[model samples]
Target chain A: MKKLFAMLTVIALMLGLLAGCASDPKPTKPAGTQGTQAPTGGSGGTAGSEGPSEDKAPIRVGVLAPLTGTMAEFGKTYEVAMSMAAEKVNAEGGINGHELVLEFEDSKGDQNQSAELASKFADDDGIVAILGDFSSGCAMAAAPICDEEEIVLFSPTASNAAFAASSKWAFQIAGLASYEGSYAATYEVGKYAGAHDVAVFYMNTDFGASIVENFRPAAEEAGMNIVFCEGYSDTETDFSALITKAQAANPDHVLIVDQTSISNVINQIRGIGWDVPITMLGPSTSQQVIDLCGENCEDILTTVSVYYSEEDPEAYAFAQEFADRAGFGATVMAGFAYDGVIILSEAIAACGDNITRAAIRDNLAKTDGTYLTGPIKFSEDGDIIRSYLICQIVDGKYVIRCGYDYANE
Target chain B: MSKIKAFVGKHRSLMLTAALVFAIVFPLFGFKKSMVRIFCRILMYFTLAGSLNITNGYSGQTSLGHAGFYCIGAYVMAILTTRFQISFWPVLLLSGIGAAVAGLIISVPTLRLKGIYLSIITLGASEVIRIIALNWEGVTGGSFGIKDIPRPTFFGFTFDSPLKFYYLFLGVAVIFLLISYRLIHSRVGRSWMSIRENELAAKSLGVRTAPAKMMNFAYGAFWAGIIGGIYAVYVQYIDSAVFSLDEGFNIMSMIIIGGQGTLIGPIVGSIVVNGLTELLRPIGVWRFVMYAALIIVMMWFRPQGLMGESNSILAGAKIKMRKAGKTGGKKEAIS
Candidate 1:
């Protein structure tokens, strides 16, 4: 009886496995990339599908993002953002008359998965360039694959300083931790001049450590006495002990260098009745952090590249349209993803009809002046060199306190 | 056809050799670089799952911290190679030994404790290792991970490509399988099974359960460590995120879904689970859903797994026609 039951189960699983394996790899409609927000302004309804240029093959660009796993929500928004950007490109006659078609592959926020997808995307000769794999770890993991295959891996959100210099094929739109970390210390902390009673709380991960590496030197140079400095694990949620320690140190200001869980630390710090002016670096420049921390999120100064209230017509249109389409205000992730498409297009355009990965990368390095955020260009390292706007959460939204060119008094 | 069968019966060993050659060379014919890469991973899981089966399946010890040992092997490989400039071959064995040392530490509680408590200890150990990998920035590279560890080399030639790594690890996986086969069929293997069947009876029969179980844990962890080292080189990069508890469960699932205790079971299980993972790519997030559903439906129908029972044919139950006679039913042959 047990043997029979086991046989039946084996047969059932075998059938499912066979069926799943046999379903030939066709492009399934990616979750968030769909028929929403009818192609506005650029080319209303003459979308590439039923066009005279139907004979021209669509130029395929692969998007490797966390469409699943812990970063799924951000990944989905990135998909929507990428789709929006692609549509805008397609509406603008795309690159040399071939419409840009994005092939969405889920990295599942895993290193192995990201690497696998990178190889898969690279293997497909039709796929011209690859954009993103969200986190720096995923991006770095995928970088070797792209490097070996000689393809572009333009990461929109990977923020590791090591990754930029790792591979020639890799390019990061996200600010390097070194520059942003030092910039935060010199400008943000130095703005208070003397009596710098800062309590620095950093995540003990590589990303946070890299920031701390630069922040400490810059802090000392600016004569900021870091009274309470603590390196907490990534899974640390209850910051009550850390907060009490910071409070006991009698700090009048706080510096949070973290990702995602910064909100929890901020809310707990405020909850422990240790209210003070806060300075957050890098990824904290998001509306998600603001929404999560609620009232405690206000007056938190952040060095940001994706300010929604930027006084630029193009930035406003993209942000407004993206927010309306994605059902949430544009975060730095969405903004960079949107900008990544623009950067790719500019690079592809710079290739001037004979588009190749090498040409695209070469053109990418020559990206001079504002594409969306400040004066943008690639440094000697593949990282983008752009000054960030200093912003604060006022009321319930992001309010830019100073422009990218804002100098310390 | 009757004459052919008679001739084949006379030269069955030669036919088996030809079949083995065909089986080995078949994948190379359709080898896309991506497919080769995928197969390398499939082989990795195969090796890992088989090791887990040594303790989890054979001894009935549910260890939720299998990936912890995997982490040890990987981190050892990562640290030694990048920091000390050690080559891959020696590091492979060192990693296995490193993980075995970790297994020895865990076996103390695992042997003394009962059921769920043992599982909790293991789970705790796995998480602690991951946390260490995250915080121990000096050696493990913190969360940035140990980047650009050199690829495995043969003489002076680098096993840098996926196809090269696939063949290298495929041989290693087969060797592991062979070692496991020998271990399972040995007197020690019989003792492990006896312990699982009835610890009191096995103890009464002069079996030292403590030492045997400890050996079993170390043996299992040794395989996991080797595979983890291979995985580190194959992917060329690894971090704490690579060996989360989910991966521990994932390896456990492959053995469970494939047919827990049998020799060929894990090999088959790893192939199917990892293959399904790749095949279900178009489904995006729903891939895991489909995978879980298949496993659930399979378990509901057959609690013994796909090839769990000893005499099951798909379980690779070898047909030894010689010694066991015409009714070679009860005394199952090893595949």
Candidate 2:
């Protein structure tokens, strides 16, 4: 009886394992099959069936997104926006008559997992290009593997200066933090806010450090004084100590550089009833900041490369579709992710019928077209120099204070 | 099952040879490159868990700050190789020595502490090391971490691919096992085990428990440091985030599940834990839940661990009953 019970337990565990594997959506299978299936059986079926691209094999692109960890929100944005882009491409009669399929594997925001998944993607012969791995650290971890494997790793949000230059195969759509930092210091703080003495509180990561390092020299050149500069760890929640220190400096303005924790810093600063003018470099046009900060976020200055306003109908349409799918209003990250897919597809489409990884990378380097974000042109280092839009939170909404050409002004 | 165990026990050397041969030729099976990477991870963790077992199992030190030694080794390799362009082979040894020295330093202050108190100190030490790695931006590169670490090469052959790394890790794991086997049979090994069995009795038996414990910690830390150096080159990146307190727990979990106090236990633990990680990848965050459940089940059914010594004091069963029986016998004799 004891042996039988043990055997039963083993069987149950095996069944659970099998169930787990079965539940996971396999990468090889076309994700749009269900949507395409109904159309194929209908009036649209005739055109799709008759098209020469129908019989050709689909071009599969692997995506390394942190689907289940701390960065799941950003990863989900990639999944939704990219899938939306793929669906639109398929609707407009696939890439050069070949179906564009994306196989997303979760990296869980861990660099080790990112590297391993990048390797797995590189191993697969069918996958022509790869996308994502979210944060700069994870993207950098996967950079060496992608470089060694001779495959393109296109990230939507990695903004570290060293990332794109780490490997020729690594390409990031997000503008470097250095550029954004300088722009924030010169244009936003130095010119717009006119705050001479500023205190900076940044996250102690690659993204945060790069901004502050660049912001300092620019801030000084713009005749602005950095009264206090400090960095807090990512997991930091209680900002009372840092706030207290910054308050001691008594600067006219405070600049917070972070993504997810921007709202927390604002809340803590406002929670202590310190009403100093606050400007943020990261978390560009993020709705969460306004939503979380409520009335405290009034007149909070930030910057963005692209703002999905109703002024641009095309971008507005994309944002609406993303909102419908993602259940959250579209942010600049979602736009970048959307542009990442469109731009990669354009590169793959430029390859014509002979689509190899090398061909895709070469064509991608030559990308000079305007994307959902802005006019994107990769420099020799495989990253773009993007112009910024100075935005301010007025009555809990991101109102554009300056256009993309504000730097020129 | 009993018959198979008996046959394996009778022909231990033969089984061992067969297993070793299989491991050596396993990568040649034309598996996917990612599968080879997983095998490399298992081999790496095997050495790491084995080293932790030396302190926690043999000497009963329960050092929870193993990641501190690991972080030291990784940073040593990263700084030397990236900054100075030092050769990988010498830096590898240097990394181990660095960690072993750190372990000795940590063990000195906590020589009198035991059980929970010692565990807490180790945990705190691990965090202190990580925080330093995070803040000391000049040497450690702070949160940016040391990236683009050049791969190790042997006589113009680069260990770049996962397949090449598999062999490097395999060679290290085998050497670790062989050395540990010999050391565990030596007088020093016996003294450490005696300390684990009963520290006071070992002291009365003229065994210097303090030095024995210190040596055990250094030996364990040395191997962890070696593995950390290899890992730095393997990932080609070293960061403070990688050596978290959770990582220390991860190594400890492998030991607990695989069975501590035995040479084969760590090897088994590495395989099972890594294998499960791959198998449960599709389950997303639930995989952690599954890991916790497995550990709990292990504790309930086999507290000493799967291959742990059942008769040893670490088992906490027969030894307690024997102590009670001895006390009762003394009372009867007095009556």
Candidate 3:
């Protein structure tokens, strides 16, 4: 038995050794030389082969997605969305006539792995730009490495302030959490006419503090009464006491100002048989929130910076196509990821033949106008200005209650 | 060939010296920078797993919370050096001591709670530590974390590049290895192992179980914290995010899968597990699934792991054959 165990150990160690040396060492190969388009029949297989793909090497974009762990589901959507973006560019004759290919690297939502992959992408000469990292933590982890190596690290969903503060090369398309909180407040006032009193049960943390601080002024300005306001610590998992306190004042609606704790508060409120309307201030914007809350999620109002509807033909088409490819509904994170690729490719194409990291950065810094998200532009700190939409959970699905009234649109 | 095998086995120091020379000259051969980074990562994990092996693998204590100590060490250095503009040289040992103090705080209370209960206490303590870091926005930077952690310096020269980091990690890892080697063969290590074998029996034999357990806990945590300090400087950023349950599990997996209680096993295991995980990253989300499958298969077939369980087929056979060879004086057949 010991001998067999020793043999297994040897086998496992060999596999590990193999994995260590498994990084791709291939030089940047010109597009249309192998696979996709132009067959080995001497470049006369397809008309599209006549493009610069035959002569120029394809631009490689490193995608740092949480492909395996808690964020694996998000990673799936991101993969489909990014590949969809890549395919769209390839169909449109590729970036600058040189094909664009995405090299996916899984961070597994770990800081260590994210940092390692960041260095790998930075070191790889083929990888001209980087996009992804599902969460803000993962993005910030890799930001310093990319910044040091002069590589552009663009994240569509890393909304943390730390990301921007980490490196000059780091760019996040997701609006800051503080901005999102304030914007949500403005959207709520616009939708509800500010006549009803508001009750807020917020988590006692920087994230929770920011939402209420921003929401208080907006709610007050809109002529809403501050009926009952409370803050709870993260360690206070039992929401019964907080729910009882919230039910006493009985404001027109209650805003659970939290991310992870929102769904808990929602479900607990349902257990008490109080059917007052609820709008989660921050967090629990994920699909899993509905899964957790079930029928209770209905009629719940929430504000989101990322608003995609079937009403918009372009969004509808992309959503439909993405669903067909991935066999799941396109998530908000996935939409941002799709837009992230387009933004990078757009900047690379704009660079012409002088497509360098600094050029990509400069081009991105000057970007403005509508793309996937309307009026997309980067501030000096590399954060995007978002026009938040007022949405309500209707029949287990999101329904827009008002237009994109943010930026007073 | 037979004579050569005997001679080589007798001159083990010569073999080790040659291997050490090979390792020292490896990065100088113009290896890829990315590969060098992976090597440094392996070395870092090597120290982490080796330290974990002290409390978990040797002492028979189940701790799922080394990450807390690791966090304490990193944050202590992050706060002291980055905040106070302190030098990195003394802080390295200070971080270890800081982690040791934290371990003492945990182990003293947890000494009464044996096995799984003790593990749970440690796990809860880790989460509590994380929550404290998350909420205390003033000192620890809260959830945003402390950035710009200065790297270790040597004689006015700062180690910045991957090559420099490789040597730094390697040297530190080697020092820890020597420490573990000496400690494991010492009287205290023997007492700890006896307690592991049977606490009631060791206690009956006049062994101070509490002191032994506490010493083991502190020693393990001390090294874990030192690695954490080095890690903070390596990444140049310290956050509450890094100290997750998954990281603790990852450290445990390194020792368990490689060969717990064996000095060489944890090193091999850390390299394999971390290397395989990193390599599998490009394969999409199935990498973790694959890794899990690998561990499940390993556990099923070899519960003692790669080098752990003694009395297994090869270990027992080698002992039997060696004893026979000694008595028979070259007359006994050896395979």
Candidate 4:
């Protein structure tokens, strides 16, 4: 009995000790918990006079990007831009005294991860808008969630035209592939005189197909004949077969919209030695493309939102600020991301304390901005009515050909 | 009452209290949305791992098609809730039952095989399920996945809130733990141990090995289905992405690292693996390398697991035993 008592006592003590030791060893809370520090308590310094509480809280916007992934270069740059916009907004006495807060969540380049991150953002009870998901797939997955919950989404670069028609909630800020295709067609017909045969080699996905579909119609309209339209899947690394087809077509120039398999495609194109002219589209036209293609990248024509030539004083100023913070050249993605946040800032300003999803949506619909991207507007379909800048590789860089606005054209 | 008697009598209540405290207080330690999301995930994987422990650990069957059952449950619940607009509770229950039925069917054929052969067949079964989920684009959303499967709801309250969802999960987990405990203590559990010890001997003792094994598989798969259903609702989405070969590997890793036959082992293993993944994100992609290394080390040093075959209660007693042993010796000399 004594032994049993002793045994029980000892066990009890040990159990208690273990429980104490095991009780939730929380990691030290990082001072800045990324997205939690929203401007608290609506603007009122006048001694406790009960005014509408709606006049106080900042508009909480979520910036969902691959803070970490294959697209982290663009994602991290967007973060830097968004951060600058927030800093600028807050510094300028805030929007009607309602400061803008951008909470950054790393979507980790997975649709499931993006969905979960969006859900988390929605749960914060403060978020009026969300900007993200550089990839169309991630954006596509997340759009419904935001839609169902009624959160305004201003995607920086999920430019799949299919998404434009998918949801009212999906408002893409960059030019869609259809727009890119039309631009490519206009450029090819105007420059190459519509007599030379054009070959289209695009990635085998909805993104690639949308652009290709647009290309055929516009090319035909411009009287430019397609020599051969070949599709390549993401798995096609060598691209020997596709390039061989392009060369066999005997085309003066080829418009290639595939970058799912990068650098290798450029090398394959160079290997074909069909050096009439080559044009590319989608988010793959940048310094990285230059780095990937090297000497092979010259004379390659691509359409972008804007070039960072430090030309437009507003763009140059923003680019300098971005470079100072992000430690990289301000690419189109960074510019769009900057505009995405600044647009939110402007919208929030327009809405004042009524920064609900409806209000944000209304404000976005009403937006007419001379942003860094040039004359940002939104179509009824929620596609950004932004200009497409034609870019050609010159002296190992993306030189601006000319800017053409969709709204104007 | 004597202290020993009192402690023994109060054991269940004490455990209940401890669990309640742990569940309630856990979220308060900084409800980082990521952490909350991870907590929901931990509850999910824990449920799956615990269910897995019933067949693979207790019954000593190396069934690799647990993910198939999991996927079936997920897809069923997702399709029912999202498409048919079924209520969350019924969908969850029906999905679990559906998965259990599927498990029984799969078990009938594969139970005849033993060891690696069974594992291989079960793996094939899981892969087949994955392929179906991928190709059945009209239903399963192909690689694109189904989105916004409604969050769990009960009575007038909706579990749309993470905090509410967390509590709902805790309730379900507690129920599962109770069910698992009751099942483990039953005569069927003893029969399972007999079969695990020596199937031939168990057969000699009129154990009806086929039915018994089928029962284990069914029960194991039922819980897996429940986890899947809850997962569909909790994540509010279901697709081939949620149910993949990698997920199968993750469940397998949980069972291996947590200690195959032990009850508490699966929970510990889930936390260790999942927690490490979240905590070691700073190490970037190499975190997977670190996790693999940790698992390898665990396998090398402690093949029987940290808790071995001992129940958590028994492990608690053993600690007491060692402490008493040390103190008693010292006291005797002093006396």
| Each prediction's DockQ against the real complex | 0.38, 0.30, 0.37, 0.12
Evaluate all candidate structures by whole-model CA lDDT and list the values in order.
Answer: 0.78, 0.84, 0.76, 0.70
Model 3 per-residue lDDT tens digits across residues A1-409: 4455566557766676655565345563442242221111211112233443667777888878776666676777777787777777776788888877776666777888888888888878888998878777778778878888999999887767667657779898766777766666666743453437778888765457666767788777766777888887754778898788878887877888875567788889898999887887434565667888899888888776665676788877887877776666665666788888888889999999998999998898777868776678888888876776677888888887776754565
lDDT of 2 by residue, B1-335 (tens): 55765798789899999999998986796777776887788899999999999999888888899999999999999999999999999999999999999999999999999999999999999999999999999999987899989899999999978999999999999999999888888889989988888899999999998988889999999999999999999999778988988789989988887778888778767766877876776555678798889888878766666666655667677644664674442221000
Candidate 3, residue A65: Cα displacement in angstroms equals 0.6
Chain B superposition TM-score per model:
0.88, 0.94, 0.90, 0.87
**For model 4, what is the C-alpha lDDT against the true structure?**
0.70
* Cα lDDT of model 1 by residue, A1-409, tens digit: 5455655555665576545534424443422343321222221112444331666666777888887888887787677777777777777777777677777777889889899889888877777899998888899899888989999999977888878788988998777877888888888776632338888999986678888889888988988888988899777789888888888999778899987798898889888766788889757676678788899987888888666665677878888887777677777778788778878877887787688888888888787757665556788878975577787779978777777677633
Ranking by TM-score: 2, 1, 3, 4
For candidate 1, what is the lDDT? 0.78
Lowest summed-lDDT stretch of 10 residues in model 4 chain B?
A: B326-335
Report lDDT (Cα) of residue B162, candidate 1.
Answer: 85
After superposing all C-alphas onto the true structure, candidate 1 shows an RMSD in angstroms of 4.7
Give per-residue CA lDDT, model 4, range A191-306, as digits (tens): 43344688888775556766777888888887788989877655567788878867887887777786546567887778667566777774666566777778888877777767
User: How accurate locally is residue A341 in candidate 3, as Cα lDDT from 0 to 100?
Assistant: 85
Off by over 4 Å in 2: A1-27, A32-53, B316-335
Model 1: fraction of native contacts: 0.49
Give the lDDT of residue A369 in candidate 2. Answer: 88
lDDT (10s digit) by residue, model 3, range B222-321: 9989988888888888778788777888899998877676777787788778777665654544666888997997676555556564432222455546
lDDT for model 2 = 0.84
Strongest candidate by lDDT: 2
